[model samples]
Target: MLFNKEYYSKAFEYLLESTTYLIIGGILAVVFGLLILEYHTIWSDNWTVLITVIGWIALFKGILLLVFPKSFNRFKYLFKSKGFINFLTVFIILFGCLFIYFGFFSY
Candidate 1:
């Protein structure tokens, strides 16, 4: 889906059109974030800090989606921008590489 622009755009459109789906997704994100934080709240180490940050970001993103679903409409324009998509793809690739390095070689 990430590599397919048409599919990606359609999926984004579907999510934007379906309010119920957004609400449900937001609820799930909140629940998952809370659960993550519940067990890994301390930021004592790199892994703990990363987990805590992810939890916090998830919690905030869910809240934003729930409270301002309409605001996300602005992002629809971004999905159409090839530059933005390229940037996102590069970022995801780099992030994945870092994750692999940390998970395997860093140890």
Candidate 2:
């Protein structure tokens, strides 16, 4: 494939930013899962299944983010607006928190 410096640069920046959030989310999810496994007496039978699924899905997504580096390049334009970028960041964080919470507490 032909290289476009501009495109690749933008893509790299966005991918880096998004991947950071993804990593943070992954860590949070894992920690929450561990917490549930350690202290919670509820859902002992199925907790393993739910935690395994969530952990696997998050790990898969994190690997995909690192492997497919171009998926987020199109978001470059969206970052131009400060409000939009903040909104997107907050939305992503909220989504991650909710995902972790559900994975831990939903059973």
Candidate 3:
């Protein structure tokens, strides 16, 4: 629900404005990647595989954001509309709720 046009614009501006985010995000991604890679086996289970892949993607995304900020322009082109963000926000919320339910209440 947070992925609004304003959030997108501001996130883009923030990435453009300073290197602090890049540095912090990169560090956090690296840490998470290492932790997940060490603690979770990529082939052990679906959840482990999912977390491992996400960790790797996070690491790669952080690197790309740090090294090639212009790469995000493609995403800007694709999601330039407010309508898309609204739609995506609802999708994400629903997907996240499903995960939450499965994590906490599913038998």
Best by lDDT: 1
- What does candidate 2's lDDT look like per residue over 42-65, in tens digits? 445543455555555555655555
Off by over 4 Å in 1: 45-48
Q: Candidate 2, which ten residues in sequence have the lowest lDDT sum?
A: 1-10
- Cα lDDT of all candidates, in order? 0.80, 0.57, 0.68
Q: Which residue pairs clash in candidate 2? A: none
Off by over 4 Å in 2: 1-75
What is the TM-score (0 to 1) of candidate 1? 0.83
> Ten-residue segment with the worst summed lDDT in candidate 1?
1-10
lDDT (Cα, tens digit) per residue for candidate 3, span 32-88: 777777786467644436667877787787677767755555565446566776777
Higher-TM-score candidate of 1 and 2: 1
Q: Can you list the residue pairs that collide in candidate 1? A: none
Candidate order by decreasing TM-score: 1, 3, 2
Residues 3-89, candidate 1, lDDT per residue (tens digit)?
A: 786767667777876778888878988998899888889877575487789899999988987997777777877777777767877
Error of 2 at 5 (Å): 23
C-alpha lDDT of residue 55 in model 1? 91
